[model samples]
Target chain A: MTYLIEGRDGPWELVVGLEVHAQVISQSKLFSGASASYGGEPNTHVSLVDAGFPGMLPVINRECVAQAVRTGLGLKARVNLESRFDRKNYFYADLPTGYQISQFTHPIIGEGAIEIELADGSTRMIGITRLHLEQDAGKSMHDQDPARSFIDLNRAGVALMEIVSEPDIRTPEEAGAYLRKLRMILRYLGTCDGNMEEGSMRADVNVSVRKAGEPFRTRCEIKNVNSIRYVMQAIEVEAVRQVEIWEGGGSVDQETRLFDPARSETRSLRSKEDAHDYRYFPDPDLLPLVIEEAWVQDLAAHLPELPDAKCQRFQDEYGIPRYDAGVLVAEQATADFYETVARGRDPRLAANWVIGDFFAALNRTGRTIQDSPISADALGGMLDLITDGTINGKIAKDVFEEMLESGESAAEIVERKGLRQVTDTGAIDAAVQAVLDKNPDKLAEYRSGKDKLFGFFVGQVMKAMAGKGNPALVNEALKKVL
Target chain B: MSLDPATVRRIARLARIGIDESDLPALQRELNGILGWIEQLNEVDIDNVEPMVGTGHAALRMREDVVTDGDAREAVLSNAPDTAGPYYTVPKVVE
Candidate 1:
């Protein structure tokens, strides 16, 4: 569906692009041997190279580079065998170095695409322009003091992969979906942790509004939106503001803006005149990064199965619906859990149980799959009792609840509670006959064209048998008597 | 390839250098002379030549991902003009 904003002139289309700064997961910083862990004592992770001591030079960390390569491969982007780092000169208290070493003219990864599925079950391919490596500045905490901002250098010189996207997102939902899919891919690749709350991943959103079939207008960039929801909301309010400006006969100016999430509006950070002029030039301290084809191939070969491929395989191999497969593969741990339960068993049944009750139980208890009270093996064992006619479905549910509460296996719970299914025809006939004798009026009504009363008979028969009677056998006995 | 006065002022402002109005003329002359000397490369006919990046032909060297340094907060912040606890302090630059 086309997303349009009805304007006084006509309908306006919102154009969006995102630049995501994903902190690379590694043991050390990009250039120094400082620990790259998230939280620490202030300035404890700062090395001389990170702190910009005079005559100190930066040496690249091999694992950071490999992490970037793995991420590029995950995105299906082109890995530039030879890439150079340039110094972007600026002055900031957070940046001890006067210049930040970043990939400017030549990025390490080029042109890739991510496929995002919308709520309507429709998919769109968002184009990725480039992915570059850069150093993150130290964090400045302005709330710590009345007159000065305290700087923590723990995050300084951390490796960040700035993934830039093309202006192909037409709606706010697409932006959210694109971010979610990108985060999922990064998490699967083990390149970035994708923890927005921890400040590991951040996005700068560019939004523009133009009438349909018209050329692009001046775009405003919203910097450092921490959450996906905020990114969507910022794009929406910014686009509406732009449309009002255009319709009111005022031209929009290109600038950088900050998203005030509390106010749900974007305010200008700087205008075009005061725009940053980062004097970029090649860094003399480091040589060009060059990798071999063999190394790239090895990384590609060892990559874990990505979400899309795993989703497709789940559908094909397990005979589950596409929606179920998509839900299962949203998280790697959940997908692994589903696979363990589905193996050598009724896959569709396993999927139904996992997607239905197991997920609901986890949500109710506020637990993740990693710490789920019921293991995959235990759930599969419960399914085994149902498949082998050891217990009826109704009894299985009670057993499942008991297993969850008491942490007992399904078979043990069933044997101890005497909740096994009564598959014997003799017992089922006796129960059905007793229900019929007690409900003679209802049976007469059921025989007299009240076909819906048949359900009532089945209910009563199962109730008489304490809900352990096999449903199919009860229905069979009830039909034979009628 | 020449440096105009306005361009010089803009460059100085971007570099956060305070330049005097009286010094603009001489600074422009010196900057233009430097650019003029480097502009000789534009006269050479080398259309297909690849830009040389660094002096050495060797690729960039990388070290293993190990926490071999850091944890000396005092040493790291020794040269700071102002300090707060273990943090380096500067005038509030909230954005």
Candidate 2:
């Protein structure tokens, strides 16, 4: 399905590109040896190099470089053996150095693509233009004081990988899907945490609009959108704004804008005259970064199975459907948990239980897979009870609920509640006969071609047996009786 | 390779260096002289020479990712013109 904006002249198409800045996961800053952890005391993580004191030089962090390489490999990008750092000069309160040390002319990674799956199960390959390494500026808090803004340099000098995408996204949903898939890949690679709420990952969105079969129009960049949902919303409102301008006999001026999520609109951040002249030149303080081919191969060899491969393997190995595999492999911990539960039990049953009641329980109680109330072994144990005829499916739900509340194993809950399934044929027959005796009219109707009444008799038998009767046995006994 | 008055003023503005309008002619002449000197390199007939990045042929040396510095907040903020509590403060810049 095509996503188009209904303009007065014709349908207008949207073109979107995203530049995502992901903070590299390392113990120290990219240049200085200061701690790069989030939420430190103000100015506590600032080093002389980070503070930009005169005559202080920067040395690269080996782990940070390896992390960038790991991320580049994860994206299936070409790792440039030789890359240089350049100084992008600008003035801002949060930036201690007048220029940001970024890769301008030669980026580290180039020409990669990520596959984004939309809501309709259709996938599209979004082209990655490049990924470069740069230093993050400190944060400024304007509301902290009446006359001044507070600056925190803890995040300054931290390494960030700016992943730029080609303008291939046609819809707002594709933008969201692209961000989600990129975050998933980053998290899977352990190069970045991909936490938007904590400011670990941020995006700059580029949006433009054009009539069908027309050339690309001027694109306005929306800067520093912190959340994935807001990215999607910004693209939508910005594209609509551009379409209206073009339809109103006006041209959209290219500029940097900010997404005001509260108003659900985008406003220009700077005018054309105030446009950025970054004056990029090679930094004299740092040398060119060169890596060996062997190092790249080593990093690529040790990467964990990525999400797509893991999702495919889950379907092939467990015989689960693609949808179930997708849900299970969204997170590494969840995939591991599913594998644990499906190790020896019936995999389809395991997937159904995990995706159904178990996930619902987690959501209802507000717990993650890492801190799930019931362990994988415990869930597997509950499935074991059902498979062995020790408990029926309905009884398992009760046991599951009890286990969630008390943090007990399924077997313990079953034993304490005495909710084992009554699998004996005689006992099931007696319960079925009692239910039929009590409901002769329904039975007469069932005999008179009202086959739907059979379900009511089964429900009555299970209720009489306290939801402990084996479901298959109840159905068989009901058929035998009537 | 020569600097015009407007280009000179723009450069000065971009660099945040305040200059008088009267200094444009002299500044433009000095900048053009410097550019003219650097432009002599274009006269050479070296078409296929690879660009030299740095003085040495060595790759950049990297440090271990360990926190060996920091924790002296007072020293870090010592040179700031103004500070509020433990933070460095500047005139409120919202954008």
Best by TM-score: 2
* Model 2 chain A weakest 10-residue run by lDDT: A270-279
Instruction: Tell how far residue A413 is off in model 1, in angstroms.
Output: 1.3
RMSD of each: 1.5, 1.2
Best by DockQ: 2
Residue range A115-218, candidate 2, lDDT tens digits: 98988998899999999999999989999889899999998999999999999999999999999999999999999999999889999999999988888999
Encode model 2's per-residue lDDT on B5-74: one tens digit a residue: 9999989988779999999999999999999999998899888988777787567888999998889899
| Model 1 lDDT tens row, B1-95 | 88789999989987779999999999999999999999998899888988777675679988999998899998899999999898999999986
- For model 1 chain A, where is the 10-residue window of minimal lDDT? A270-279
Off by over 4 Å in 1: none
lDDT of 1 by residue, A1-482 (tens): 68888888888999999999999999999999999997787899989999999999999998999998999999999999889899999888999988899999989999999999999999999999999999999999999899999999899999999999999999999999999999999988999989998889999999999877888899999999999999999999999999999999999888899999899999999746558688899999989998898998999999999999999999999999999999999999999999999999999999999999899999999999999999999999999999999998889889989988999999999999999999999999999888888877898898889999989989988989999999999998889989
Alpha carbon RMSD to native, model 2: 1.2
Judged by DockQ cut-offs, is candidate 2 incorrect, acceptable, medium or high?
high
